[model samples]
Target chain A: MQQSNAPWRTPALIIVAGCLIALLTFGVRAGFGLFLEPMSQDQGWGREVFAFAIALQNLLWGLGQPFAGALADRYGSGRVLALGGLFYGLGVWLMAHAATPWQLQLSAGVLVGLGLAGASFAIALAAMSRAVSEERRSWVLGIGTAAGSLGQFLMVPLGQAFLAAYGWSTALTLLGCGVLLVIPLAGVLKGRAVAGGATSATTREQTLGEALREASGHGGYWYLTSGFFVCGFHVAFIATHLPAYLVDNGIAASTAAWALALVGLFNVIGSYSAGVLGGRYSKKYLLSSLYLTRAVVIAVFVLAPLSTVSVYLFAAAMGLLWLSTVPLTSGLVAQIFGPRYMATLFGIVFLSHQLGAFLGVWLGGYLFDNTGSYALVWWISVALGITSAILHWPIDERRVPRLANAAP
Target chain B: MTGHRHAALLLLAVLAAWSLLLGLALWQLRLNDEQAGKVVVLFPPAWDAQTHFERTLRAGGLVVGQAPLANLWVVYSEQAGFVGRLKDQGAWIAFQPAPFAIVTLGGCFSGPGALPPSFLKTRRLSGDRP
Candidate 1:
């Protein structure tokens, strides 16, 4: 097989394209919370209603990621992203017009979630990895993750401004329009699938059963799955409930928005730093340290004085720690198993994250409705964070001995 | 081999670009920080509130100060409409009615049957016990 002209150019272009796609997908999704109160109030619905929908969206997103990744690995990422963009656009539009809770759930939860699975980092990273050298994969993965973080930062402020200017409904419609921007970028990923004689000779070489069997049989995969669950729990819990918690605590809405924004802003640093550090250190240890730090941070935050300064301090500190795990965790999977089936393996691990996400997002609202406070949820997060730290600590990061000895 | 090297250089270029953009954003935030002002308002306790008031104050470019001798602390805003939770109090209330009025309710703060509708707007601040 002959290499393409400008080999590095194509890979770098692919990563950039992946970044753009990630930016659009996550950017819009992060601002879903800003719509919660307004949408609930307008429909005379409960916070649980909105929370449930978002939770479903998160679960579905998680469920879809690996499958999307698998499809991209077999078929092509460009098509997956293109289709995802369409579904994202349609889902956001449907959400804007949704009058019933079920309708909201269907639009925001199922459609948007599935859409994200296709266009998200799972697919993007896989595509980028195929284009780059093995040695640069971790750093490239970091760049891609940071791109999503950048999207969160840029889009949160943009979403806020849109909400302030156009109301939630119109804002969502505009965001849907922005999601369509991915359609064009998808073109870049076309015809870039890595070709292998072995892959083509055996149509069953990369079957879903094969991928599942490979991951399930591996001890490292379980650790990745368990550790990822904690990430989902922490992110979903914070994203879904932080604003309301701030409002409930007598903090102003603007400050809450900034808190959320700061989370994204600081994560830019955290994610990049994690990427760089992961390149230098053991990725698993870095992940363990991040989770432990998150546990410690949450404990200090809840126990400390409730002031604007303290909250901002907490946001900045946590933000720096947030999402840093993504590059490391994803990089480790690619390192241990290789990128051939990375999307599928990573997707399954992400499923655990989403399950945690499902519980975190749903339980936060449920407990709030039941007990009228976020205390239970915060305690749960602390426990989960500590547990995640423990889980990652024992993960064997060495390559699978079986795969290492197999014919190349 | 040469192609791989060029690819490596290109990847580095993209990384540099992304880092620069992030750095610019952080710099902009720092500049904005220097211009921010402090606003003070009284928050009543009784309402079981979270960080809403403080979040809103920060969003409005005001620094939330510590509680004064009275039960109320200074919010960065001079506006009367903002609501917040009182420190160590159980209920939430607005900041503008009167600072001295809130201080008078000190011991009875957040006690059942004592809070009026005004207090309902403000919840108790987290970690604050009355």
Candidate 2:
């Protein structure tokens, strides 16, 4: 039965807990790149070696997201998150001292990927979604997404300073400590997620199998997934390679850090605005326009002369576009399938996103190694942005008939 | 109602603590101690020039370590007369005196080791532009 513990313990605690998890997990993940040059130099390996490991991590994260949600669905997100935190801490700790490339792959790549799956924004966002009122869902989702931006803004410099002060191994161990903070936050999210919102009291709970079947058959769902993949590609490629690109081009390392921080800082606004806007407008159109704008922005950035001014401008512009898609994409999934199976459906969609992330990060390194440049990747991002722009245009945003008929 | 209020309050307190931790972490990152009087001395760009350039540093005083950039040596204790001798010997030096800047960038990558403060800055590397 769907029951609320009370108002105090209800949505408020859930939101705070969810947001904190988003901040910690996302924040810790964002700062890993600061260790790249230092780590590779010490290990006597190429940049692609480190890049490939992180790319594998993203691939594993994508592969694990759906299963993590499934586990959360079956056994409750609390236990799953606890398990995730454990793995995350262990993976980071192991990564800190990994002496061999294979070990680095296992710890940073495989284990961290699995850990992220369990502790990702999906679990927290899904928990909050189930707890909040339907009318307030998009607003709450935006807040959660913004917290992720906050994490990136705050953690990057700290990670850099830590890398500078304590060395990369000790600095990474500190990040491991930071991620462990999520484990306790998971406990507060205890209790089963009720399929709240528009579903009536008499509506029967949909089986996981039924939801999967419905989503696979829906053309719009496929479109949404494919569009989301582009988001992952753009975000991952930049996160992994942008700093190195700037540094390689004779720009100060601080500017690269500032650029990333600016992205995180502005994404707070972008994500929140998208959330607020989704409630009043067509999410599909908004998504389409956002993608189109990304294509234009990337084209302009690449064509323009590269300078410190250009870099900061690009960061701020991209920041506004970055992660804004999260609330909308997840909200669309919720709207289409109803909030009942949101974590699972969205997780599957997120899988596609991670797949794109894997390609983006991997190809950034692979191509850079072969060609001695990131030029090809930049144009590829522009091309993917256009494809996603068109793909998101045709998504049918109307609620599925089952949910519509069942609602009051 | 009381239980709900207590839960909300508790959660708010947790949030406050988390914010404090993040603020503290950022504060910690800003607390870098300047590596006083450190400098990256650039040897002439030619590949064959590196060995002789290293020899000049050894003859000048003491080469602290081999830098990442080719023909760059991290030298310690800038001797006033000795710097002139190195300059006369055909070496360009970037004097990083005090209160050096640290920049932090984000990438979702892995960690390996620590780099010296001198290599972290680009403008100090080679005088390409302003």
Candidate 2 per-residue lDDT, tens place, A1-408, comes to 132344456677777788788877777877676677778889998777776777677777888999998888766777788888888888898989988888888988888889999998887787777776666678778777877766666665566556655678998998898788788988877655555545755234677788889888889999999999899889878865777677777776767766876777788778878877877788888899998899898889878877899999999899899989999999898877777677788899898887787788779879877777888898999999999989989888888887878777
Looking at model 1 chain A, report the run of 10 residues with the lowest lDDT sum: A1-10
Give the per-residue lDDT digits (tens) of candidate 1, residues A1-408.
Answer: 111224434765677788778767876776676677678889999877987887677667877888888887767778888888888888998999999999998998889888888888777877776666666777777777877877666565455446554677987898898898888888776643544433333322446677578778878789888988888778767755666677667776556656766777788778767877887799988998899999998888888867799779988888888778888998898777666667777877777877876677678879877877888889888998889888888888876654454426
Off by over 4 Å in 2: A1-8, A37-52, A97-102, A196-203, A243-254, A365-376, B1-35, B39-130
Which candidate number maximizes lDDT?
2
Best by TM-score: 2
Q: Rate the local accuracy (lDDT) of all candidates.
A: 0.67, 0.72
* Cα displacement (Å) at residue B103, model 2: 4.6
Candidate 1 TM-score to native: 0.71
